[model samples]
Target: MPTLRRTHPADLPPVQRRELWAWAGYDFANSGYTTVVITAVFNAYFVRVVADGADWATFAWTLALSLSYLLVAVTAPALGAWADLRARKKFLLAITTAVCVAGTAALAACGPGSVALAIALVVVTNAAFGTGENVIAAFLPELASEDGMGRLSGYGWGFGYVGGLLILGVCLWWIMAGAAAFGVDASAVVPQTMLITAAAFLLAALPTLLVLRERARPQPARSGLWRTSFARLRQALLESEGLIDLRRFLLCIVCYQAGVMTVITIAAIFTEQALGFSTTESIVLIMVVNVTAAVGALVFGLVQDRLGHRPTLAITLVAWLAAIGLFWFAEDRRLVWVAANVAGLALGASQSAGRALVGYLCPARREAEVFGLWGLAVKLSSVIGPLAFGAVSWASGGDYRIAMLATSLFFVAGLAILATVDVPRGRAAARVADAAIG
Candidate 1:
């Protein structure tokens, strides 16, 4: 297995406050993309307008996202290894961010009967977003101590929700203004939200580009970058007994993150379809949910660092299960709102804790590559979870309630796998691996 020659954990560079915030800037920058385009505005628009409410529209949307995820799952691991080898996480971060911004901007051209244009743009934009997400997360272990990693990650994630809120809040105001002032309907104004989100992302990413420095030293260039990456990744996974716990935890991530992604991809559309929420109502619901999620991530970040990553994560999983149950039996919009809030609370913590735990278990010098693998795991869940939910909905003739309830199985599976992991042991193994590589 490839590993970095490095000093002990305490000997690493001290975290700079400016750099830390800049690092978090990427999170803040990108949340708007996911929140506005995929979760809040565009997905519903594609189904209701782009496809003109076709029966297969929901499935098609999920397929588009899953296809992007599939491409990431195939490419990110190798790219991660390349970034680690070349010390190019930031450079690659720039490329992916640009791709996402341009792709999201391109989404504005899609209106009714522009399903192909919409799906194609979504695929490119989301793929770029997912890839960049991996590269940015690779910075986590470099910037914070194991004890503080969860808290730091939470800060970024929680702050990211605020970013999402800003963009969505703006979109809401714009939609209302267009309705009242120009007498335009949502369909006419929705395209502008895409432009708004893309511009916000570009602005938000500037801090990270300017201030967040790359700490990983480049490896000696070797023959065949792709081959080297895959070989190293394969060797590491196959031979590193130290990472066994991390491997198990990855399985847990796959299961639970599926549930997370499913909810995110379907939130707005489900709200409108199942509970009679208008676009305005769905935006309001998600805005409130984002607030709760922000609180959850920040509070749980400290709690995880104090109580331990595993227990805190377990708590969030329990919350997810409860939320799923509530949504399943919800007979009214009020009940659905309750469930959405419950889910919002779990959303950030579950994702933040999972990523932090992976960082904890990762050996020195393997941050990007492992996170790439982590991205692969997450994208795989993205492919499976949302696609599964959409499939169930399609198969059941749009029985979205049953589809939503069935998602509980993912969290349950994640909980069962999570029980088997030993957190302290994993961290110890990582330290030992770093020393061994050195």
Candidate 2:
């Protein structure tokens, strides 16, 4: 059985190489859901076909996503606490994965004018996906030391994009190539698209379920789940008062991740509506972006470890601002392509850097609890960014360009907060917290 190296309290959890691969595999498994359902096919499909291009289509889509993120924000801390205290991260993760897979597959039953059905299913799938994202991430510290965290995160993210690209390729082939020959219209293949994502998610998730070990030792039950977890959360927050740098970092995450999440949720919608990209072209563009994002994840992961996490994240945020500027004024498809690739590069780097920074600052034996708070910050940003963008579009009669351009404010806000975070101090605080654990 795998065991932690306890020569020192500050030492990281011991992880087998294969187990690390299994851990990364969960990232791979879940990416297809995001790439297909949220980014490429389903969002646009819902906006255009399911809602019949109504003025509120965009708003409705965003609302579903916003509600899901809000649910995660509300529930993640409690879930994390429960999982950690019970050594049931795997069990909870499995439940979430099952919900996501089943919910995504159920989307196949949604068709034209099935807006309510589609929205409801999307909420279930996305909420499950978002919560599971945090649960899986709680294992990061067990797999790598501080120095290696960025690289490990980057590897997983890179592999995730590869999963996304693979699924997109399948989607493109089925929609543009195979379906036409089978006397099937593109719209008729929507069920096929949903099924593909669900199957892929189930298949890819198996490695993590089968091979990854649950390493946390169970603590005795303190009380009922809600009260106990909330009590733990309150205590963690009190202790975190001394870790001011970590507090600042969470604010940074909320601001920057807001912009990033906005782009992820709506880029395809923008291109299709503003740039007149057909579904095929949209898929192609996203596939290319996924490639660039993979490269950015790997390159920036290495750079952050050598150059310092704060600087790495700062560079990416600046790049995000620049990319958003280009996107704001992009009137031609070529220019949109340029803007998107730039955003893609920044997207991968910023996500990798931020996650690694959190892991670096997180206290030992409290991965689930602290990361739950991390999840709260991220999900709150998700709620704010997308809901704000959707509100703008809805208010302006679907003036999507104005809404798209407005996301830059989030990046600016994130940078302002990020500058205040002291990475070294946060790391030191975490170490002290770790050493104090008895």
Number of the top candidate by TM-score? 1
Per-prediction TM-score: 0.95, 0.94
Question: Per-residue lDDT of 189-289 in model 1, one digit per residue for the tens?
Answer: 88888899999999999999988878888786566777888898896668756678888898899999999999998899888888889888899999999
Q: Which candidate number has the best lDDT?
A: 1
Among all windows of 10 consecutive residues in model 2, the one with the lowest summed lDDT is: 1-10
Q: For candidate 2, lDDT tens digit of each residue in 328-350?
A: 88877788889999999998899
Local distance difference test scores for all models: 0.88, 0.86
Let me know the TM-score candidate 1 reaches against the reference structure.
0.95
Clashing pairs in 1: none
